[model samples]
Target: MTFEREFFYDEVRDGFYIPGIIKRFWAYELTILSEIDRICKKYNIPYYADGGTLLGAVRDGQFIAWDDDIDIMMLRKDYNRFAQIAQKELPEELSFNSLEVNQDCEELAASVGKQVVGFAAELLRKYHEYPYAGSVDIFIVDELEKDPEVEEHRSLLLRRILFLIEAIEKHGKSKAVLKEINEIEKIMKIQFDQRTALKPQLRRVMDKIFQEFNGREGDQLAIMQFYAFLGNCKYPRSALDKSKWTPFCGMQLPIPEDYDAVLRAEYGDYHKKVKGGGGHGYPCLKKYENKLKTLMKGTWDPDYHFSEEDLVRPKIQNFRDIAISMAEAFKLSHKQLFEDCLKGDISTCISRLSRMQEEAIAFGTAIEQKKGEGTESVRVLEEYCDALYQAYNALSDLTALKEDGIEKQKQTEEICRSTDISSGLQKELEKIANTLLYYPEKLQTALKKDFKRQVVFLPHSMKYFESIRPIVDAVLKAEDMECKIIPIPYFDKYGDGSPKEMHYEGDAFPKEYKITDYRTYDFASELPDCIVINSSYDEFNQVWSVAPSFYSKEMKKYTNKLIYIPWFVTDEINPHAKEDEKAFINMEYYVTVPGLFHSDLTIVQSEEMKKAYLAKIEEFAGKDVAKKMEKKIAGAGSCLLGEKEGEGIQNVVDCFRLFLEK
Candidate 1:
């Protein structure tokens, strides 16, 4: 199967590419989620999707293409209970790995839930390290504890210092996951005078904070390990109390009730534009070499418990290189950035973070378009992953620094006052967030028939263009919205027509269209912002509906909604057949069967027309298609604004408006 640009888009590929790898992983993910849903529903265990999993559920109602992990959050109590019951309840192939079992862990798992990331990690784990690798990543959310009016500023400072100390200590302890990374940070010869002594104090602060705020439900909640500053993240308490079921990877999953506020707090604007789709910042999929065998057996992990010796360092180091390399470009150092954040130098800290953000995006785009997961591609992926990790950490630490800005100045003669990247950084994140809204999915079904512009595909024979012009004109005239009519003349059948016979209705589809070697396949890119094909009404195929020769699959690449209008109302227009060639030919049967299966919305001339099409579908396709076709197919006589002509193109135009008004 050829690679698809997207993980899941159901249609006739213009160039015949099938996304087998992503599709297989998609199947595996759905199975695990479905099982989890079964258990959760049985117990009424409340969990809202967290991280990229939540992003996927909301953004496109599916997993972001490169995202491999399924992250979900639970209140501490619910998480504890689910973990206990899940061990035996989950099948052998599925494991519930948490901090207790896998000790070399830094995943403030609230408790590590599941790591539904696909092939690479699982297969590599057979030859490698890291313990918290399940199908789901679980994090804990605790209601904030209120006691002694917790000094948010002091606690915030303590948290940053503690995190920095821990990070610095771990710096040289673990081998740089990449060869280049091992050498890159040599310049950041970071040193801390009180590191050893400070760690003991850091523990005390952490313990004291958690002890004091352990049980109280003050106002906000804590999502990570830092319990001292109970209210720093300040997620609304109401976000977790209730949830609504949202579609995710083709399954309905629970999401926080107050998702808007939650997403804004976490991602600024969660729906910005970005390349390669979004999720927890890594596409953990492996090429589907064994996809068929796995799919047939229906298992995500054939060997859930594999080896534990090899290193994913080479894998993870590349990202470290990308982050620090990009940081150096802006003359900023990650070590310095973190150190500045510790001393409350918010200005320099954010400046470095801003650069990190840029590197992360550009680096991520390069990874997404990589031709294969070769050594270089893996390095890019690791860099992309690490950059995101570092960037998010920077943002989190920045929040902490701002919280403690007032006191840090008095303690140490450092820059004072809270600071924020309210300008370019905010804009940068917003732009990237909006870019993520348009990821690919299984199918682009138009749940409703709607269009901003109608690109009417004319027949190879230019004569039909003038005849249908009035109907197109009437439809444009009827709608209140702006309309651009593009009359694209193409060979309407299996093989016929020269592109040279073009008649332009507007500048959109020029009269003397240049690309004269026109084939239906060539029009995919030039399609308007929105369009639809009438299943039976198109000028495709022979005049009669019996022969499928006059077919137009030109609209297959259209990501927008496809609308259907009844083809030449033969019975109504000319009932007397076989006697007059004009009567019979013009009134020939319109075969809608070609377009019936693809309809997002189907419009008909009358209620009887809807029934006739439904019955025909039932006879050919089956009762299932007929039943669904019945609901999607509609007949309104006409929804046009102008006076109705019982037998003109006006009726078809009116049908076009039915979906829009709907």
Candidate 2:
């Protein structure tokens, strides 16, 4: 179970260095792969390296530098036999996670059509100092219709069904959700209970559909777990009917005899190197190391141990500490204020005093609950509060004197210098006030509950309008929702600040949906509940940049929520694969743009893409910001898919509602 192989940094490819940590991760995964190979061989079962793992073996003769996991596929029959015995056959150090062996893995099991039997080293912590434990993803390849059109039809049907199953699990069996499920069942000529564990029943139906073409002649093969758009999942039966052994990470591994065909089908130009980590991110093993450590220690909790209300007392103490600092500063300024007006320009002092007054008012409102308690701290705070009010009046009087004339200005300056206000007092008071105002309880209570929520869609160009259209349509369908489609202007950047050309596509919106002119829309005054913008790149876009006014940071001031949805879609990439990483890096300009970094939430096309966006964001913006952005990035399947297939629209709508509810 222990990996004896010592790892070190080495240049596996030109200019691509595999660090010791990643090398160790690869060794850990290879151990699991070797164990799987042993079990398959003992049981006389057949499996072949799939996806990025296969690509790496054939193209690189080892694990891809950026790839962090191993993937292997088995035909449906072999997969079933292996699943039946893998748990008992695996060594004590290794454990298999699947629906049959562990119900906790049911979601993952259902997502991948049948089961994704993840083999992990249970004694990893006991054996290794590094907390990370890598796994081998076991996928089941199912048979599909031979004809391309029929195969597409079957794939689409299964995709829609899977989407509904996910929706049912996420949103519960809402009436609309159930209706969509029923429509799919009717098409398949099947029936299931409308209530009482619909998810499991839908999963059973999917299983039935997956095996429909099994045991039939002239059937094509496909991995049904991934999105159909991935393009590389489908293959000819002959692709895997024959097998050959290949060197992978210094170990001989099983690969399809027609690996060229399989790799080509999955990744065109398989020999090319691209650098990007998998959905789990670069060095994906460490992504969940902490969570696993907690679980292993039996310290993980499924619920919050403390609530926001519980933080109120601690926040009050924090505010008091800040108040104490401000009060000490006031003690020094108090004598000077009585003797003279202030030391600086009357206008600047007036501005600071005004801000101090606002902070005092806000702090007073925040501490209203403690007013009747008659605490000693409260009594002292009241005294300083009064003094702060008087300071504001004194500054106002100096402003009035300055407006009088030059002689008045000289007198004001003398008065100010004699007063000598403590410059830091204003900052301290503002800090204290903000701490109180942003208390979890205060923020929770301040949430707006409007009768009708307004969401404004700002699409910069007609070409990418479809990206936000599904969300717009979903919002309009809601009884309590209203929206405006405001197509903003953009310019072709010409290296200089000046634009090469200005383009406005407001008129390009479909006649059915009214388009509001950006000039006419009062963003600051209207205060839309949510502002959805499709454009992410601002000034960084080389070819085109949206008008600065529509940038996420600026629009945030005018809306309660700012949502950024990508204007483009991409095929699924192996997050751990170096080749995929390279592709993602090429897209860094668009993926890590300001809109994504600044927005309250970003809706990506799929979970795989979300990982890419997050990894790149972390790489560019740093881990702290990426961690915060994690909750903000959601993978609601792309609307472009629905547009192309004329389905999955409801699924996309349901995903939007799910994220918006949060």
Q: Which predicted model would earn the best TM-score?
A: 2
Worst 10 residues of 1 by lDDT: 439-448
CA lDDT of each prediction against the hidden true structure: 0.45, 0.62
Error of 1 at 128 (Å): 24
User: What's the TM-score of every candidate structure?
Assistant: 0.34, 0.43
Q: For model 1, give the RMSD to the true fold.
A: 37.7
TM-score of candidate 2 to 2 decimals: 0.43
Tens-place lDDT digits, model 2, residues 1-662: 44432342222244343434455456657767777888889999999998889988887787775565688888889888888888777766567765555433533331111121121333433323233444678877888766778777877887887788778778887887978977987897888765467766665666667677788766467776553535667778898998999987778889999888878777778787755434335555444544554655754321112122311211112233334344444434333332222235546544554655565455445455523344444443454456556656655553564445878877756654564355443333333333323222322222121224677889977778987787888887786667789999987533122455688888888898988889998775566667788776666543356788777657777765678877666655554665566455444546656677667777776777788777776776677766777888887767867744444556667766765565
For candidate 1, the TM-score is 0.34
Name the regions of candidate 1 deviating beyond 4 angstroms.
1-20, 110-134, 145-212, 225-233, 275-281, 286-662
